[model samples]
Target: MKFFTCSVIMSVFLQVCSQNPLRYWTLLPNILVVEVNGSLGQQPLSCLGSPQEGTRKDDKSQGIIWRKNGVVEEQRGNSYLVQLEESLGGGNYTCHREDGSLVNHTVVLIQEDQTERRKILVKTDQEDYLTCLAQNYNGEFHCSWTWNRNRVGKVALIQVGRISNDSDAQCSVDVSTQRWTCSSGQSNFSCSVDEHGHRISCRDEQHCPYAEEIQQIYVTLYVRTEQFLVENYSKQFYLAEIVKPDMVRISEVNTSMIEWSYPSSWSSPYSYFPLTFQISQFRRGCKGCDNPCTESKPAKTLMVHFTDVCQFKVKHKAKAVCVRAKDALCNSQWSEWSHLRLRRNNKNKHRQNDKQG
Candidate 1:
């Protein structure tokens, strides 16, 4: 019985000594082996002391081994090699020591390639309300549409569809309420906008006439803000010599020199005004001189000579007169003729001279 008691004490002591204090753990190929030293006895330690089911803690004093199932290698060292079963998504991971102290770790999994989402469908058209096309859209993410350039029409807020997730955007003219609607089918779209103040009419996918054509129709407006008073001036008219020498005697010269004079009152203080004159000569009771002579000139005062000489016999009536002159600003009426009645007899000339006096 004494011997049995000694053996029992010895076994207890050996078990206590085999429980090592300095233990090192690491990962190796296909196995997790921990090494314990500095103890009184050398014995194999069971790694499954307490089942490390989940994440491991980082405590040097604790005798627990915890790791994920993917950790295929473990050994007695500072670090261990962990073989992952599959790629890990971006998330947080922890490494635990035997003492239950944990080290937080982050893991990122890289994909082979990246791909963008494609749009299902894209469309555009005109709108009646506001000015542009009423937009309808459907999608999961946010979408937008815009005119590529500034347009003649007014722009409004983008309209998003409730049922389909469709969004619409457009710009339109103010007067006619015409618009061009552009949308990104999935990613991008393009459209043109006019900056000029003109009406744009889109027909069958074509832009209407430009702003220049519209400006040609409407005259530019000019406004003056200054104030001033103007005085009213009365206009006056006077007889002016439109045709010089209104009367011409066919017998006075081979071609008569006709001259005229105007009233001083007819002169204007502003500038010279242009006038046109017409002269006419008439004769009666002469067979060869029955045809009248007439001439016209554009001048303020004109001197006209008659090439047709009078062939009337004495005692025949011949009349030469000054016709009227007309212009944009003024008009002068005809003057009375100085009638001459000739006689074939020299005695009749003396009588006519005496009668004229």
Candidate 2:
């Protein structure tokens, strides 16, 4: 039912957007976005001569003019102090030289009402719009989200820290590097958005794998739509809970025996952080030949520890083997199956893989 409503809103928006492209130009990368709480009484915006320069802002005093949505505004000199008692300030403000040359521009977005959960991105098959995963306990993770069919959005701000109430935590993006950094007392994290703009990879430099996690990591993503609307989504978790091992790399050792190994992306000191492998094998004439792995009974199932054993003996009638792995210490997601078909002839002809039961 929610999806149906989104489709209806999308159709209506498409018709309105087609008629005016420049009016919705806030989606462009050139303009900066400022999020404001409309409930606040007043706000001040400065029209700096070198606005893009971080350290030097609001330095322009002479020969400066301000305009809101391309309309000239005579609100004091180089700066406009607007009242935000009821709504988001002037839609988009651009600073121009006295001769009308463009200097810098910004769009002000009123933060969405948290209770209503305004729609900027519709949920995918998942219950939520965001999906995050970590390959190992290396203090690194990546989060991704799918875009809506009718809306184009970009990451306007990212806030990450150990506590959700970290009032001093601030984030800033470097467009040239495509990287952003968040500074907080508990943890300082840096993230880089991918070129495609669909995903963000972040790292916590202070992570210690040897110690237990006492606090949760909190992450919030602020996305702005083309129509100057903004919405925020957040998540919190401990890295261990989100760790997912990569697929196991299985290879045929010989016709009578097969072996498997850990994924390359897994952390070192295999014994300290071991993996538990599950192997399922089936006979050539198994009951479910069409989907052998799922239907066939595993000839042999072994839960071998890395330090103890990594190989398994194949059964005489076994035709194929499927293997997967998970963190031995923690109950986590399983890796994808590594499969291989065995040959009755010499091992060189083609070796069977994974030690089944």
- Model 2 CA lDDT for position 223: 80
My TM-score estimates for the predictions, one after another, are 0.16, 0.71
The model with the greatest TM-score is: 2
Model 1 weakest lDDT span, ten residues long: 215-224
Model 2 lDDT tens row, 1-357: 999999999987665434321122232354433434334443456666332442243345556787888898886345565544333553687778878988777776655345545567767686777778888888898888887767668887777778755575677778564798988777889998898877889998888877888888878887877666677788888887778888876777877888877888887678878888888877654553665666666766766666445798878777888888888888777777777777654443334433331
List ranges where model 2 is wrong by over 4 Å. Answer: 1-65, 68-91, 101-105, 164-168, 284-302, 345-357
TM-score of 2: 0.71
Residue 232 accuracy (lDDT) in model 1: 11
